[model samples]
Target: MRLFSLRTLLVCTALASCLGMVGAQAATKAQPAPKPSGQKVAMLGGKFAFTLPKDYVKGPMEEIDAKARAAGVTGSLYMNKPAKRVVIITETPLPNDQKVGANDKPTLDGIIADTLQQQQSSYKDFKKLGEKKIVRKGLGMRQLDISGSVDGGRVLSTTITAAYGKRTAMVNVISLAKDAKAHAEVVKGVTGGK
Candidate 1:
């Protein structure tokens, strides 16, 4: 199954409006070093932070939102584009009526299963690459990898989802299947890898 549908994944976050245009412009013009410092950049008024690898530029939010709208998911989108890889961060508030306990494995698993079903119906060549459940910094998280052909090219996608109270965060990394390994570090940085 294709691990991620970029368009679908795009709407999963609510932080799109929080992405500053000035920062996005500067990120595009700046030449990142070969190895970035791996510093966490605070986003959404300190709700969360992400570390973009050196040499990756944040894409304009407007453009990303337009693409996401076309795909039918609406949310804030933080996209970092390196030479060969794309990492996207999305956050959206859970429905006001929804409540997820800290140890709610059944609820979390159901969410993931729904996502997988959506992918299976949306992509022609979706394949489940791998997945695992882990606790990161005391939060329950799920990591998934999947591959598929989109727009006639093979793509590999890695997605990490963490739910905290009434909010959920999802980070998606997409790369050419052959180049996915090269971007592993970038993905780890954004996903808060151990």
Candidate 2:
């Protein structure tokens, strides 16, 4: 088993990044993968399963994204066109040397910093809204919030990352700033907030 890398996590959210910008830039030139027909997504051989919101149809969906192949990243993307919202779930194996332990505050901090920097560079007018640590379903997770400009619109995003064995899973929820309330609900749903 292995651990996840920064590159892998980045690939996981590229869709939300690019699509949020209305293709202001291409994060990866990956060819489109078959679209998933259902909103229910099963990953890691069904070890993890999530049912997305009704309107969030799967994205140029793929079992493994080509651009992220070398990094051992696999993901599923869901897009809610009517609301211009996106949800991305990514799983990646981290190298043994880079394994992140549950109490690895330093490692988690570095990851949060790197992810924030990546988002800042990817989105214009970027601002760090807030961040916090949360435990959901007995899993330790770090949640981050940020706002940035994309496609002449401001987008708000929340990312929740957790370590599972040698692999890491990252889930990102993105929406236009005008839809922050809905976006918060979406994030809360994933984080199991009341």
Candidate 3:
């Protein structure tokens, strides 16, 4: 039973550095965290909301935080057992000292490139399936689809990154490569895409 840990995948997906900063911020924050209302999980002070899948089980934030701490990444985890899929939502604050322009292309591009490199090094027979720039709910996001072999089975990873104000939210989905189409549909459903 080779369980492909999403925590491990997130660490190798270039989210560790950004997430490390988020972890530090979390420790120093004085305000109490807000709990999710119903099916929507609030992120970035309610600037973002992720609609949970109807059939997926949501893990406790404590467990998610502990895993992130162990992996040096920050994110909330949602899992669908029958589908063998994991969806993670991570938020990282942009550097406060520097002035970031609206829709900062260079910064986002750098993150994308770094993530691609990390994926290549982390997985066996890694291949970039496709990538595209898209707008979701008026926010610009970069989406990447990557396929690789994990524990003798092919896996597909889809990562979507969007910048909002002084923070960036990343949503990553990992599923068996054989379920690529189904996984895509799942993403579309969760994101409210046609």
- lDDT, residue 47, model 2: 39
- What is the C-alpha local distance difference test score of each model? 0.55, 0.65, 0.60
Better of 2 and 3 by TM-score: 2
Could you give candidate 2's per-residue lDDT for residues 1-194 as a string of tens digits? 12234433444355445455555543433222223333666543443445566667676545455666677777767777666677878777744536655545665565677777777777778899999887654566788999887656678889877665566677888776777777877776676676
Compose the digit string of candidate 3's lDDT tens values, residues 3-115.
12443455344233223333344333232211222367666456455666566676544434555455433567676655566677776655443334435677667666666
Clashing pairs for predicted structure model 1, backbone only = 1-126, 1-127, 1-128, 2-126, 2-127, 13-90, 13-91, 14-91, 15-76, 16-76
Q: How are the candidates ranked when ordered by TM-score, highest leading?
A: 2, 3, 1
True-vs-predicted CA distance for residue 21, candidate 2, Å: 9.6
| Local accuracy of candidate 1 as per-residue lDDT tens digits, 1-194 | 21234435353221222222222443333323325454456533344466665455555444345554553333333344433456666655444446665545775676577666665665458899888786655567677788776545566777776666665566767665666655566666655664
In model 2, what is the error at residue 192, expressed in angstroms? Answer: 0.5
Clashing residue pairs found in predicted model 3: none
Whose lDDT is higher: candidate 1's or candidate 3's?
Answer: 3
Candidate no. 2 TM-score: 0.73
Give the runs in model 2 whose Cα sits over 4 Å from its true position: 1-50, 61-67, 96-104
Candidate 3 Cα outliers beyond 4 Å, as residue runs: 1-38, 60-73, 95-102
Residue 30 lDDT in candidate 1: 32
